[model samples]
Target: MARSPQRLSGTPDDQTSPIPGRVTAPALRRGLDILELFLDSSEGLRVPEMTAALGIPRASTHELVGALVDRGYLQPKPGSAGQFVLGVKTFQLGGAYERSLDIVEAGREAARAVAAECGETVQIVVRDERVVVYIVRIDSTHSVRLVSDVGSRLPAHCTAGGKVLLASLSPEELATLFPDDTSLLPMTTRSIDTVERLNRELAETRERGWGEEYCESNQDVACVAAPVRNPRGECVAAMSISIPTIRWQDDKRADYVALVSTGARELSTRLGARL
Candidate 1:
């Protein structure tokens, strides 16, 4: 089957962008890009800073910066002079993302169910810049267990949810996603140490439609994960459970695996996935 055309650059810089009648103007896109960097840093950015952050020419950045400041997208901070911060409009724009009800509704149901069934921590993550962004978390029942929070970033190669997400991606896509000679950061001694090993493991995950982690992130933690696919059958996210190695023995282990699999399938069903 043919895949629908997606905007590769996401910049909306093309003259023939989308429906042909509408296109993202260069100044609007650059201004938005410059405005986005504010969320990542504590200090406000200057024209020279924006130029360096975007790699756009200093002349163009200066003009865009001026336009943004004039339009109230960027304003001066109280304590800092010459440094410009995100204005009211910027936050107002971000409020729209906060108001998004679907993501909240989906996450609330998923977090509660997974945590209730497994009696352990569960997280739903979205891939962001070769890392998994932990968006929701449900705490464990036991005193000794894994803990994670929303807005935390973890390596994609070392976590059960991350590996399941990786398995859903194509090799070509992986190559495009990861930087050259990417360093495989090991959280524990058992973390996959090389591209070759990680590749092989992800392949197995794809085949099984599930992922398992044995002290890969922490020496005492064990986890199993399965994907929550979308209506299109693409793995959009994952549901997982964390268990202490001491509890992951015998029939207890089987119970953990079964719970994770069933929970993931249920989440996928809620997402409108057929399988």
Candidate 2:
């Protein structure tokens, strides 16, 4: 099944090659195809599964997988007979990538600067299931402390960063996350429960380039967040700042939003995010 030239332009990223030409480069395509297979399957992959999935002959699969294993792209499972999974070398390559713009590194500088400048807690979060997990945080030096820590997961609809990230997705994608429609539990009275309402808020966040939560996750705090995107121009993370309701209502409210949005944008820039 071959396609005309025009259709090839929109070929999926998973595809290994472009239309056949000098640019096709068959070996490079095969190598990329092998690598892309691991993206969706982090778990153990057997020889047969690789062979079947790629429609490659048994001998070819063995050679490809073997070459990959020897090159440290794949590793043999400990207990399994001959199954392979992504290797530490792959992770090292990924780690180099992670370190290049590292959310933690970039995030720390922005978070700390924002916290110091604005006197509020700044945090960087990444999406995890129906929630967003706090990965890096910089707390304000104020006398009053907010209750949050890294590695902690909070409901997506209940927090500013979570809302911003969730809103980045489309209606169809959101539905896939919460199929029952009732899977969204309200953490506070202000949490968005209805899909329609959440959708509206998400649209607003996208337009404004930021999001907000008023006593949603925590009844006494107000939070603001903006999306963090990767080099590929996809939202990869979020950065936020939370202020206690008392201070949040003060004359500094306008300044807080500006400071937080600045921090978010700074972190996004370091992460290679654009627009």
Candidate 3:
């Protein structure tokens, strides 16, 4: 007996065929393609440029760009109509990726070692706009530990780590991070309250390649910090040791500085920094 021809389940172009793996999402791919186009253009990009370069339909490009702008991945350039640039959230995501690097784990280990050696509180922080966020911390071996903990944020001007990270920024970048001088509120009487004073402090920090805070954030607390750089020699984080005023010795400042600076350098080296 002859068998009849087996008819297909659906149509020849059935998209819902039982595929074993995940399928490609055209919209997502298109969005990613649009984003990658900006990698070659640092200044700004226009929808027409994307459409012309990527061979995407003008309407689709407009919709995609609009969606990205609404989602904070792309932003309109100031004073340049129809021009787009990467948004703050994009920069934030890049920073997040940088912090998630294996070197951050090394930094954590270094922080613990430094705390054990100095018998003091240790912290590793990164700047987020005008604030410094503590990402890693190790408490002092002594009963009197510092009040700071991981995830705590403080004004960049009143903390040693904050100053160190701030010192890494260029003048224009620093100005953009701090446009309104009045936003620099004083955390304490000793805290830097003016851009001029903060500039001087940052200058000193850059000169020393380290930063210090003496009774700025807290009267009884003091800190010293050193830069932790990335492979490109950019300061990506700051490592600091905090001590109580009672335990702080004028002569021992150099020793504390050496301890933190060494730890930061070692961590930076692990992160592929030159020095």
| Highest-scoring model, TM-score | 3
RMSD (CA, Å), each prediction? 16.0, 12.6, 14.6
**Whole-model lDDT, model 1:** 0.76
- The global Cα lDDT (0 to 1) of model 2 is 0.78
What is the C-alpha local distance difference test score of each model?
Answer: 0.76, 0.78, 0.85
Q: lDDT score, residue 237, model 3?
A: 94
Better of 2 and 3 by lDDT: 3
TM-score of each: 0.60, 0.62, 0.63
Expressed as tens digits, the lDDT of each residue in 104-188 for candidate 1 is 4686587688789778887777777578887778888989888667888888888888999998888898777654435678889
Candidate 1: segments with Cα more than 4 A from true spot: 1-101, 179-182
lDDT of 3: 0.85
Candidate 3, which segments miss by more than 4 Å at Cα?
A: 1-100
Q: Which stretches of model 2 miss by more than 4 angstroms? A: 1-99
Question: Which pairs in model 2 have colliding backbones?
Answer: none
- Candidate 2 lDDT, tens digit per residue, 151-251? 99999888889988988887789889877648879988888888778778888888888888989999888988878877566888888889888677756
Residues 1-275 of candidate 3 have per-residue lDDT tens digits of 11112222332223342455654455666677778676657788888888777666899989989999999999999999999998887778768766777855787898988988999999999988989899998889899878877788999989999999999999998898777678798888898888888899999999988999999999899999999999668999999999999899989999999999999998888776766
By lDDT, the best candidate is 3
Q: What's the CA RMSD of model 2 in angstroms?
A: 12.6
